[model samples]
Target: YGDLSKPYGTGNPVKARCPPNNVVWYTLESYLPTLVYGCIVDAWVTNGKCPYACKFRYESNPEPGPFISAVNEVITRGRKIEKDRVVMYRNLLVERALERLKEIYWQWLKLSNEDGPSLASLWSTGTVSEIPTLKPFCSLVAEKKQLDKASRTLVLGNGMVRREWHNKAKLAKNFALLPNLESGDLNPHFAKTALMDLVEDAINYLEWVIVWPTVVQAVRSTPDGQSHLDPVIVLDRS
Candidate 1:
């Protein structure tokens, strides 16, 4: 609000913002179908980079291709998620839908788009990889909701139910956000926190679901002290 002299340097803040890269390196318009465009858009938006670490290049027109209007719509929705902080469930649903769509995209590309006598394969190659699934993380939300409802209605419980619900929700939220998390090529710290939270959740959940049950079972069966089952062996069998 103070200075307007140096427009390019500071005044024109809108134009000073960084724009996303364009899809110029790959012939997406020529090869990929229009329906799969949204998947590419989601991958780009969530990761802040093009799918498969595509080659960077300059383009006169920075707009998305005409065939990729669907992708633009999805990007618009992600913006709302960033603002309101709600609709996480909807975002997860969108990720799953795009994951399914990309399967068809990859199959079609493999059959139709083939490089002819190109030495590019010797050096490197571009590929549309499978987007990870969000099912396990989504399940956490549902389970948390159940715990929350039980906590409210339980007539005899103390604080155990509510505490468990909060713990599970935190874990699930960490995992769900992993799909949208991006690791910067220049700065490694961008994705470290989210990745660590996810790994911690997995380890804790595994111990609760698999390890604890086996240990209890082994302890109960060996009350006579004649024989004992090793916890490691039980978990390994599991």
Candidate 2:
């Protein structure tokens, strides 16, 4: 019915024209080679997926070079040094403030008891001249000193450090008022008034030591790290 040597598309009428939507026809000799080439192309594309592979490399890789590790070490050491300096200066300020508080309390106690016991005590003790020597209130002083030491040791800075010192000083000043209270040996009304006056002084000292330094530090923009090393606050972080 057709020329035997002629291909389907050339001369034969048995082959059908391919539909545009569902064409599946192929040349018999070309099909295998096309499939093979397609698989090879897909494999090549998949293998070359990471074009920027160097940029995403890990730091901890076995062959990673030298400079990264050295820089990291320097940064770590610098941070430690800065932290230590901050701690040192904070402690020094706290100690000085505490010592000032102690001196004030001692002076207040001594001034409160100038005249000794009243005449009413003559009946109970016999001789008024035999009054016991003031014991210096050493135990109370020691307790305050211990607390001061503890506060100094605590690592604090910025506003928090200043606030803590102010609070502690206030408490010490309040405690100093104990001798003047009615419950204490001092005359009730007079002692209370004197205590109130001393409390005001305590408040003043706290402002002087804690608030003033903080203001200076703020004005200067002192760094928490190196601020401790310098007696005066310096603003530069470096």
Tens digits of per-residue lDDT, candidate 2, 71-149, equal 2333455422344543443343333333332333333323324555332221111121122211111122224554353
lDDT of 1 by residue, 69-175 (tens): 33344345442223232234234434433443333222332343253312111101122111011111112222555445331221111111122322233344332
Error of 1 at 179 (Å): 14
Best model number under TM-score: 1
Q: Candidate 1 regions off by >4 Å?
A: 1-26, 29-35, 38-85, 112-238
Estimate the overall C-alpha local distance difference test score of candidate 1: 0.29
The RMSD (Cα, Å) of candidate 1 is 27.1
